[model samples]
Structure formats: C-alpha cells, structure tokens
Target: MIAASDADKWKKALLEWDVTSLEEHPSSDGVCVCGQTGLLWMYTITNDANGAELFPIGSSCVNHFGRTDLNRRVDVFHKLALVQATANAGKPVEMTTEFFSRAALKFLFEEGAFTPDSYNYGDGVNDYEFLLKMFGKRDKSTITSRQGYKIRKLVTSKIIPFVLADPRVR
Candidate 1:
C-alpha cells in the first residue's frame, strides 16, 4: 500500500504540475462517494450566475468494481489529473460530470490503476459516485444518472487536451 506521506508527495507534485490558476474561488464543503469530507473546489464556467460546477476534493472507492491495486492507482492518478485539469482550464471545470466521469476513468484503466472485476457488485453507486463519497460528499442521490453520463462525455472531450498539454503523463 502507498503510504499517506507518499500520497501527499504525489499530490504535491501533481499540484505543482497542473494547478495553474490558484486564485481563490467560491467553494463548498461536501462528501465524496467514499464518505470523506473537505472543502470542495468549485468553478464558474458561465457568464451567468447560475452556471457553476462543484467538485469534491477527494472521493471514495465503494463503487469501483475492480481489483484493489488498480482501484488505488486510478484513485491516485485521478487526484493528480483533477489538479492538473483545473490548472489547465484556469477555473473549476465541472468536477462531478466532466473531470471524474471521463478523463479519470481512462487514466485509471489505461494506466492500469485497477484490474477488471470478474464479478459485478451491481450496486446503485458507480466509481465516480464512490469517488465523490470518498472525498466526503455523503449524498449519493445528488449525483444523477444523466450527470454521470455527461461526465463521461466531458472526460472524453478533454482527453486530447489533457495529454497534449501535460507532458508528464506522456
């Protein structure tokens, strides 16, 4: 298992590499799918006051239907990717739908963050929801099926940008 110190080190490195716009924006406290809680980072993507995305900092793994090692690595890689994606965009990108749903999954599976599961848990929650809980957001109901699908699209859209812009992963 990766030590907390090691994880912290990885987080720090990822922050240095990705988090570009460090200016403080409005944020809220929420739970991740994993059941952890902290200040969730948020960003406004629209000129209108209503268009904003809330991203929980760390999420859980309850929904991950893969091997332990893969799940852990994917979790770690995603933490790094989130910081990088935010930095690259210079604002809070949609964490719930965009970041976690798409890019994070690819990074997790492609990077061998987790191994495929032989059996399905068939739980109502998904890996993303699990991540949300892990980060401390308790309300799994808040994440909807549609939102999950959107997140997948968002991640697929941003893959090229993320890989092209960030040389570390390449």
Candidate 2:
C-alpha cells in the first residue's frame, strides 16, 4: 500500500531530509509528501542543510529512510497516542500493566516524566519505585484498586499533558 514517487523532483525533495516530529490526525484525511492519501499520522521532515521543512508526510515515506531513530520515534508516537486516548476518555483511566508495558514506562521515564522524588506517598517511596513494582506484577488480580487509581492519576496529570504539549521525540 506504500509506494515512492517516480518523478525526479519528488525523488530529489525526499533526499537529505530527517523527520523532526509527528502530528496525529483525528481522521485519516491527511496526504503524504509523496502524494499518498488517507494517512492518520503526518510526519514533519526537515533538511538541516537548507532549513527546508516538509510536513504531512506519511509514516511509509519516513520508513523509506530505514533510520533506527525514526523508527523508535514512530513507536513512541504510537504509545503516546494510546496514553492520550485513555486520558481523553475522562476519569478513572486504567493503567493496566499489560497496557503500560516496560518499554512504555521506560519511554515516560526517559522523557523525564518519572523521577526519584516525583512520587512520595508519605511512605518514603517514590513513584518510580511504586510503578516499577506494579509493572512487574504479571497477575492482574494482584494489582490493587488504589494502585490503579494512582497510576491513572499519574497518566492523566503528568504523561498526558507532557505528550500533548511537547513530545520531544526528536
């Protein structure tokens, strides 16, 4: 379903560009730089040499570069979308261990959303420690309602706003 443009101008425009950031469309109505339509995610690519930025490019076009950094960014974007969706749904957001995998938590951690002193439940234990403990429990039945509430609040208050304002994936 993905194809590159055959025109020389398009080929030239595609080269030497690196993805800077991505924007998610509420619907699949976006068009790619290569003329691909029906894209839900649009990537912005910039040429540092010329300071030229092309926007609304689809993920397939980005994948054409085969860059690991770009791929990782795409993955982060998907995870961000999931978090956003839950936050948008309103109160009582569920932070299931399976839903928030180790990678997703690590991404949040790396994004500076989680720190040693961020979560202090008056028990001398930080949020990072509590989250890691919850994440390790594979048994869904072991996760308490109170723990789920804390995780939900964390996602709603911290992660959602951070991702919405500035993802910093680039």
Instruction: Give the poorly placed runs of model 2, Cα more than 4 Å off.
Output: 1-18, 47-51, 96-101, 115-133, 167-170
Tens-digit lDDT string for candidate 2 (105-141):
6667776775334356443236656777887877868
In candidate 1, how many Å is residue 31 off?
Answer: 37
Task: Give the poorly placed runs of model 1, Cα more than 4 Å off.
Answer: 1-78, 81-136, 159-161
List TM-scores for all candidates, in order: 0.22, 0.66
lDDT, each prediction = 0.39, 0.65
Clashes of each: 31, 0
lDDT of 1 by residue, 1-170 (tens): 11212234543422221211111223546454345655343211111222222233232322232335434444445455565656567754445543454445545445433322322144323443444443344465677787556544434444335543544431
